[model samples]
Structure formats: structure tokens, C-alpha cells
Target: MNQWLIVPVAIPAMIAAVLVLAMRTSMTTQRAISVAATAAQLAAAIGLFVLASDGESRAYFLGHWPAPFGIVLVLDRLSATMLLLTSVVASGVVLAAIREWDTRGRHFHALFQFQLLGINGAFLTGDVFNLFVFFEVLLIASYGLMLHGGGPRRLKAGFHYVAINLIGSTVFLFAVGTIYAVTGTLNMADLAVKVPQVAAGNEALLSAGALLLFTVFAIKSAMVPLHWWLAPTYGSTSPAAAALFALMTKVGAYSIIRVYTLIFGADAGALAGIAQPWILTLAVVTLIMGTIGVLAARSLPDLICYSLIASMGTLLIAVGLASAEGLAAALYYAVQSTVTSSALFLLAGLIARGGEGRAPPLPHGTLVIGLYFLLAIASVGMPPLAGFLGKLLILDAARTSAHIAVAWSAILITSLLLILGFARFGIQTFWNRPRSDGAAVQPLPFALTAVIAGMVAALAALSVFAGPMMDNMTAMAEQLIATQGYIRAVLPPAATAGLVGG
Candidate 1:
């Protein structure tokens, strides 16, 4: 087991406890501690990413117990990629919050750290049961962050967010219980071994359990019918929290990819590739509807929320392909979208500071306009930006699919719709500004501008490094699909070889 595999989860857990119990009173100390911890997380994630590049899947078992009997944390190309992404985004959000958003509520820093714990935990956990535990941990912390500033509107939205997630939690438990009953194990690698050997008599029960888990991830991913919760929930939260919440939905998407590719993949006997049929159809609808939402949005925040939904639509379409090509595209797109969307949210916070209604002229308005221009074209997947490359890769990967025409048509049409929607918002926000009545134009603080600009710069860096990044993602997808390697990393060969009749 690699020792550093535990750093992502353990460091955040320790720091969060300290913030609550040790630095409870001093906001300055809290800020310092949170930033230090986030920096450490980023450093650790970078090291792990480099280590994982060698194509090895590693596991760290809790209490030194072997798999199928104790909790285990697995790290591989997929998890390592996500860990690095989460750390980068979290580091930016913490800095963004420090300027103003942190002072809005008590324990904001604490909740922030806890959510990191959950997000990182979800990525690192190798057992289905512990994944659910991390899901709840993140959700619980998000509840506090969602309602941080405290208003009637925020409170109302937070209630709906909490209620639906509670339902998701209930369904998740039911799924876990059903799976455990059938396979007699919750460790994912164990399931990878046992799921293929499940008796025909029990296939239906196992399929039901698997679909139920998909439902939970779908809701978390904000897929179609379940996507309604996002606009209201995100629209009401503060920008800093909303920026961080960007990964919350991605976790659901991640779980779907991880579980389906491992347990119910092509080798799973009668239950092979079950999610294959539904992924494309729902993804097309999600793309169309989400872009339409972007077109119809009345506020900057609403537009961003809907745009995120639309981006997820684009992402899942790639994932649904289930080929090395498609999965690789999905991985690349996921990284760009996360960074782009978080940056957009932070920019929205800057715009929102101008107060309600049409945007008013402010100091450094020219620079803000320039940032919006770059992000808008990127968001709409225009030329030379990372988003454009991501979509192009997805389109190229779809060529071998049975649904090629449909996939191509939906993506092409929605790209136009997204362009129109973002164009309208850009004109409205930067061009059709309200008349100023000699209002003092206070310049944006240096720290806030630096953080948002840094995020935008990361997107540019992604574009520049697309060749190497796509190559890496292709390998990661291959790594993800090879269940034998992943299983061996968790369970000994003797244990796996003896599981012929498990």
C-alpha cells in the first residue's frame, strides 16, 4: 500500500477538526490554517499524480486488514486525476472566500474543510459502503455552506436541497444493502471478482440494486428529471460556495463511471454493460434542455447553473460511449469544464457585487469585460480553447457508436444554442449596462482579481497541454477498464484465483 494514498483524505479530516476545536474563535487563525491545509493538499495531490503516472493501481487498507473484510482506499489514474482537480479548485475557492465570503457566516472555513474531506474521500474510497459515507459527509457540509449567508430565499432553497438528498441517502442505503446481500461484500474489488460469478437466480436482484445506485448518482449528477434541484440550489448560494459546489455534481458522475466500469462491465456475465442503453438518450435530452435553460435564464447565476447542467450533458455523452476513445474524451472534458465553470462562478460573484438588476459600470470594467469575453467563447466551445477541444474529442469518439448521428446532431445543435445563449448574456451584462449616477467606482481588491484570473489562466494552460493531457487520459481510461489490475491491487492473486465460484 502506498502511504501517500491516505494524504488526500487524512489531512483534510485533521485540519477540519482543528479548525472547529482549536481555532474556533480567531477568524485570522482559521483562514491561515485552512489555506495552509489546502496548499498541503495540492502539493500531496501533485506528488500522487506523478506517482500514479506509472500505471499502477495501489490500495491503503484501514487497520491493515485485507480487502473483502476491511475498509480500503484505492488510488489509480482516475482517482488521482480527480484528487488533483479537486485540490486545485478547492485551493482557489478558499482564497476566493478569504477576501469577503468567509466573513459572511460562522464556521464557513470549517464547513469548507469538511466538504473537501467528503469530496476527497469519495474519490479515494475503494468500498461502496464508505463511498456512501463520504457522500453524506460532503452533503452535510454543503448544507451548511449552502445556507451560509442566511436569508429567506437561501433557506428555502437549502431545504429543497436537503430534502431531495435525504431521499437520495435513503435510496443509497437500500442499494448498498441489496448488493451486500447478493454478493456478501461491499469492497469494490471483491465485487469485481464476485459479481461475474453471481448465480442466474440472483441476477435480477443484483441488477435492481445496481440501477438503484445509478439513480442516486444520476440525481447527484443532476441528470434530467433530477436536474431541477441544481438551478434553485445553486442560484441561492454564495459564489464561493457555489464555485466549490461545482464538484459535488461531478462526484455523482464519477461514481457512475467507477461502479459501472468495474462491477457491471463487459465481464459481468448476464449483467454486462447495463447502463449502456440509457446513457446516450438521457444525455441528449440533458444537453438540449440544459442549453435551453441557459437561453431562458434571467440572471447571471441562473445562466451559470444551467450552463453547468449543459456541460454535464456534454460530458456524460462522452462517458456513455464507454470506449477508450470516448472515456478519454470525457476525462479531458471533465477537467476543462470544472476549471472553466468554477472560474465563471467566481466572475459571476464579481458581477453580482454590482447589486441586483442590470450590471452597472464599475472600476476596471474593461478588464472584467475582457475576462468575460474569453470565458464566454470558451464556455460556448469556440476555437482554440480547452472547451472546444473537449467537445471536438467527444464528437470524434462518437463516430464509432451506433448512435453516431444522434450524438453528432445533439452536440452540434446544442453548441449553437450555447453560443447564442452566452452571446445574449454577454451583450446584456457588458454592453447594456445601467446608467451610473456619478457613483464612485471602487477598484476590485488585488487578491480577488488574482484568484479568478489564476483560474482562467489554468484553462489556458490546459489548452496548451492538450496533447499530453489527452494521451494521459487515454491511458487512464484503459487503466479504469482493466478490472484485473485494479482487483489485484486490492486483493491478492491467491484470493482472486480462488474466486472462480465466488
Candidate 2:
């Protein structure tokens, strides 16, 4: 049962390799294999979630190798939640891709599976080095997926995306090297024990390395100053690709929460709260910028991308609080944003149909308009949707913070701005603009529409289940704050003594 921890990463890798070997075969075969593999992964993820949700953490050391010396995969509530989220979104994206996007180019199924492999690996790995390795794997897969449909727009965006991430990766390597030099271990649990014990002379060096590592996550999370690459990169990609890319940002958020709380929490002596001020300021700025971008967006895709930035901003605000309440809210909001953003991206594609400006009204214009409205409400945090509850929780979590007023003001104003922006978009696209003349419009495929509707239903269900979900999130947050569980799960008892330089 413990070995099943690796199944999420392993199954996709095996499927991707098989797909590559049979590359010459029909896409039907590839699609069948890819979908089946993802389904199995989702099941595995669900199982992991159930096991970990009880406030217990589990770790698997590969080949029975000792902890810190061999690769280890740890599944706590946080990782399990992330894995489940990835699999759910991947499942939806895969269904949408099958509706024509899969055949647009060669190796779509293979790349997609590899992308999942990387994402799952990132979520499960218990070591800094393998985390970086998984980042590269997912990124390499994304570069291909981003250019799947192939156009000057996509090529240009992909170039910028690759270039920016390459820089981030280089910085990540340097940060890892610095930490390894300081602590003599790359295992996160060991780092938790060792980081605080770093000699006084190395304090500044440790802090700098940790900050540099966070800079990488900041870029990935699209935090204000480092966020420019997101809009263009996500905006120009194929809708299916963009929809799947939704979880990519959360990967950064997850890494930030996981590492910061585990390795640099209040226990980390001098490093404690070092990142708090910067993260809070960045989160505020990100919220403001994302709202402005949404208001200024000229296309549905751009709106969705900017909305993603804003959602990240909201998620980060909770993260900045650095408390159990805040982390719980952050986890809840993380799920809401991931699902909402992915749904909107997928819907934006069907509505836009790859054209510019606004998506022209198809024959089923009313239904499309309705779907847009539902997603827009969810995105803007209006009532009866998960977004509203998420915002409320974040605000409540930050009630004692010095910047509570500012957080509330930003969230409220941004919500209104988002509502107005999406309203204008709907009016222009559905009411004001005439249909494109001399163009043939095909009704969206049942599978495609079904996928979108399914996501909307999921959002509704998230609202319905918010109570129990938040309970789980609260439990998860508590487990995270008590880092001893994670540490014990990853490091052997005798080896643990070495955490303090003994």
C-alpha cells in the first residue's frame, strides 16, 4: 500500500513511454491509453487523499533506501489534495482535447501524459533536488503542449515562456546549490531540522538562498513584479493547453506553502517571517494588477489569464497570513481558483473558436452566454459560488492582521471590477457585436460542452461541500503547522539526530 504512493507518477510515465513507442499508431489508440492512464491516476490520487485526509502523513522511500539518502515520496493532506486537483483538471482537459485538439499535432497524448507525470511528481517528491527535476520535466512537457496548435502567436508566446522559465530554472539551481552547501542535505524534512541550526556565520547566506528559491516560486506564482510572462504565455496557447496550465500556478503556490511552512516556519530561528512582508506586499500588488488587467482585457482568453493572476493574488493573501486559519482558507481558495480558471479557459476557447477580440455568438449563443455568466460569477466571487466563500474565509483569516482593511478593500473592489469587466465582455460578445459574416460556425461538440458544464457543476458542488471541505482544509493546515509529522515521516529516527549537527 505504501508503494502506491508512487503510482501517480509511475503510471503516467509508463503510459507516456508506451505512447511514444507506438507513435505511428492511430490517435484513437493514443487517446484511449492516455485517458485510461489518467483515470487510473485519478483513482490513485483519490485513494491517497482519503488516506492522508485523516490528518496523518505518509512517506515512501524508494527501493527501501534510507531516508535522506534515496528518493522519497511523501503524501500528506496538502500533497494529496494537490494530486487530486491535478488529476481532476487533467481528466477534464483530456476530455476536451479529444474533441479535435488531440489530432492537431503529433504526440499530443504523449506530451499530455508526461505533463501529468511531471505535475504528480512535483506534488509527491520529498526532496528539493527531485522537486527541481520535476519542475524541468513538467516545463519541458509544457513547452511542447503550448505550441501544440502552432501559430506565430503561439510560437512567440512559447518562446517568451521558455526563456523566462529557463531563467527561473537557473536561479532555482543556484538556490538549491546554496542550500546544499549550507546544510549538507537536500531533503526538505532534514532541511526543516537543519536550517535553523545553521551556524551564525551562515545565517545571511541561508536567508539569501531561501529568498532566491522563493523568487523562483514567485515567478511561477505570477506574483506582481515577476508576473509579466503569465498573460502572454497562457493567453496565446491553445485553449485546452491553457486550461491545463491552470494548475501550473498552484504548483508554485503549493511549493511556497510546503517549503516555507515546513522548512522556514517559526522554528527556523532567524529565517522566520523573513518572507512575510515581501509576500504580503506582492500579493496586494498582484491583486491590483490582475484586476486592472481584467478590466483592460480585449479578449476572452486575456480576461481568463488576468483572472488567473487575480486568483493567485487572492490565494497568496491567505498564504501571507502564515497561520493555520489562513492556510486553510488558502487551500480552499486554491482549489476554487484552479477549477474556475481551468473551466473558464476551456469555455473561452469554445466561445472564441480561435478568433480574436471577442468570441462571436454561435447559433447556441444564449447557452454560451449563460455558461459565460456562470463562470464569470464564479470567477468574480459573487454569491452562491465557491469563490465568494473563499474570499470570505481569507478575509476572516486575516481579521487580526494589520492590513485586514486593505485586504478587504482590495478583494471587494476587485470583485466589483471583475464583475463589470466580465459584464462588458458578455455584452460586447453576445449582444453588441454582430456575428462574423461569411464564416461557418459549428455547434460546440457535446463532449466539449459536457466538459464545461461538468466543471460548472463541480464548482457548485464545491460550494455545497464547502463546510466539509473547509474542515478537511483546516485539518490539513493544522498538520502543516505541526511540521513534526512531516519531518518524522520523511527522516528515520536515528538519522533525525543529525538535524541539529550532532
lDDT of each: 0.90, 0.90
| Per-residue lDDT of candidate 1, residues 312-423 (tens digit) | 8999999899898999999999998888888888888887787744645667778887887788777878877799999999999999987799889999999999999988
- Against the true structure, candidate 2 reaches a TM-score of 0.97
lDDT of 2 by residue, 392-420 (tens): 99999989877788788988899899899
Name the weakest run of 10 consecutive residues (lDDT summed) in model 1: 493-502
Task: Tell me model 1's lDDT, rounded to 2 decimals.
Answer: 0.90
Pairs clashing within candidate 2: none
The lowest-lDDT stretch of 10 consecutive residues in candidate 2 is 354-363
> Distance (Å) between predicted and true CA of 264, model 1?
0.9
Off by over 4 Å in 1: 435-438, 498-502
What's the distance in Å from true for residue 422, model 2? 1.1
lDDT of 2 at 293: 97
Each prediction's number of clashing residue pairs: 0, 0
Which pairs in model 1 have colliding backbones? none
